[model samples]
Target: MAATLDWKLVVDTHDAPALADFWAAALGYEVEDNSALIDRLMTAGQLPEAAVAEHNGTRIFRGFAAVRHPDDPYDEETGIGRGRRILFQDVPEPKTAKNRLHLDVHAGPDAREATVARLESLGATRVEEVNKGPAGHWWVMRDPEGNEFCVA
Candidate 1:
């Protein structure tokens, strides 16, 4: 038998919190809140105040944020998701090329347009449309920071 390992998708972004919020809303996920852990670290004099910041009234790590499936199990003490998560980490460089890998969101047959529209309202830009005959169609879209994802 093979050993099982857990994993998460991590994206580099100029603004971790913003990207985390955008993805959380887009995927119906919840933003992971690490305030309790940060507070504990600070109280123990192990973390500096400059290492955290207030985002939307929540204190989060300065260069990282994450979102997880709302129903996924998570650690109560640290708010770290144990399953189905995406972590956004701050990068000094800007995104200048197409993503090598991208996410595909399925919205069934009738909800594609509405789903795309909703995503647009949340800062996604339509890049183009893809049609594969019998394979069906999907919209190629870019997130606020230019990462591409598809809605089908």
Candidate 2:
């Protein structure tokens, strides 16, 4: 038998919470609410106030924030998701090149344009439109942090 391991995709960003918020809205995911865990850690003196920040009326790790599928199970004590999720971590440097990996959002051909427009309204920018005639159509887009993704 094979063992199953849990995992999440992490993205480097200048602002972790903001990026998390953007992704959550974009994917209809929920931002993990770790305030209770944060408070407990603070009371235990295991985490410093300097290592936390207030975002969207909640306290989150200073350089880390995450979003997960709304229907997924999570650890209530830690606010860690147990299913599909994405973590945004703050980094000192800006993105200087194309992403080695990217996300492809499937909205079907009929909804592609509207989906791209909605993503744009949520701070994503269109990089280019790719059309292969009868083959397919997609829009290469960039998130607020310049990470690339495709809407098809």
Candidate 3:
């Protein structure tokens, strides 16, 4: 039997390492370390020596990496992580349409505009805005990879 289902959201990125860093700051998450896995794979000859890369003193997988909130439960030594995580995976093609699942940021309404501006400065762009009568207003924005996420 399974204890629970763990969910991690992954976004396609061109630079998984840099994006992991950016999201670490933006979301107060810690980047996961994959060195042990890499080492084991290398020892088994499953991964080529050149397939692993390092950035900012962290061992990186060739096309994917993840970050989690620092306080989230993580293995003390290995730092193979869990909780409120986002993984960045490299994909050759650009994002061409809407995201099947998107994040809705729920900061207070008064903070929306400033938050939008801040995210814009962080490489996210406001793509659409919608308002409906009394309790409706949101800005649909695209991240650097063109994935849609909303701020409401």
Candidate 4:
């Protein structure tokens, strides 16, 4: 029998909040709140004050953030998504090379240009465009933190 698992994509960045905001805008996803949980931890003295930060009037994890699909189910109390999610974790070093594995955003055949423009406005830089002839075409882009992903 095959095993089933729930998963999320994790990305390392120098600034987790900024990258989380950028990706949330790019994918039309919602930023996971986690404020309620943070508040509980803080009140119980289980979490230090230095381990949290206020973002747009909400308390969030200091070194981590996440974005989730808009329609996904999530926990109301904890603000954690129960479906598709991307977690951004803080790391000291900057991205140094091309990503071996990258995400491909599908915008259908006609919406590619508009999608690329929107992504560019959201802090993604176009690295190059690839035309595979009969196969298809896609634009390679780097996110704000230099992680690569494709828009097709």
Candidate 5:
């Protein structure tokens, strides 16, 4: 039988922590805290001091950070989400093309405008308004790092 597997969406960013923070607020999720694990790894000489950095007084992997659903289960030792999550990893290259995959946030009909405005305040830029008449309506938006997503 095919087995179900836990998974997370990974996003490439120039600044992992900042992108993670933005997504966490945008999605009403919580930033994962993996400081304890980092500390243990560093003490064991497994991870180098240069591999980590301080964020909000906690140590995070220099090139990675993540956000998780607030009500989801997670590994206490590693701070890894077992349910819904988004992992951000740093990449040296800038975004060069439109995304083939993107997130569509559902805010329903009445709240679309308000939701779009809120997202804009959170560092997302409005790319365009997409109106499908009877099918649906949404706003194409770009995150701080220029990743595309929609608010519908």
Candidate 6:
């Protein structure tokens, strides 16, 4: 109908690279690199070399990068991307409230609670724990930026 929605999630953060790194490790996603494209741009004098920066052996736009589930589509050569991803973009302002949109991660069995604890160990904090209607239970937590996410 609507061209079959291409993606299912978007997570925003003030520190895109650090946020991307956190999510990448937390969600088992691989950090993406666009070094080749940057390289091409720099070589053609279309972009300054300073615009490209390297991190963890991957080249990307300076001050910005992203990560995605490893099995998801990602181009090795150009770093143009596809599949599940979280693009970290640079932004100003410390997050000051619950996010209007938040991620609800699935943790198996008593795992939801355990996941909450784990996320807390990783700098996330519990905001609330509550049961949704039948067959649903979740714990709200804030990311490092105070943006909220849920584990259920």
lDDT of 6 at 21: 72
lDDT of 3 at 2: 40
The lowest-lDDT stretch of 10 consecutive residues in candidate 5 is 1-10
lDDT of 5 by residue, 58-97 (tens): 8999999999998788899999888889999999999999
Per-residue lDDT for 67 in model 5? 97
Number of backbone-clashing residue pairs for each candidate, in the order shown: 0, 0, 2, 0, 0, 0
Clash list (residue pairs), candidate 4: none
Give the per-residue lDDT digits (tens) of candidate 3, residues 37-143: 88878889998978998888866788888998676677655566655678899889877777899878766699999888888877888899988859889999877
Model 5: residue 140 alpha-carbon error in angstroms: 0.3
Q: Which stretches of candidate 6 lie over 4 Å from their true place?
A: 1-5, 8-10, 132-135
lDDT of 1 at 51: 94
lDDT of each: 0.93, 0.93, 0.79, 0.92, 0.93, 0.74
Ranking by TM-score: 1, 5, 2, 4, 6, 3
Which residue runs of candidate 5 sit more than 4 Å off their true CA positions?
Answer: 1-5
TM-score of each: 0.95, 0.94, 0.80, 0.94, 0.95, 0.81
Candidate 3, residue 82: Cα displacement in angstroms equals: 2.3
TM-score of 1: 0.95
Q: Write the per-residue lDDT of candidate 6 for residues 1-152, one digit (tens) a residue.
A: 23322463655567677777767766777877777888888889998877777777877787687777776666777775667767777766666665687788889657877787877877788888888678888888877667777888
Off by over 4 Å in 3: 1-5, 36-46
Better of 1 and 4 by lDDT: 1
Q: Give the per-residue lDDT of model 2 (tens digit) for 27-66.
A: 8999999999999999999999999999978999999999
Better of 3 and 5 by TM-score: 5
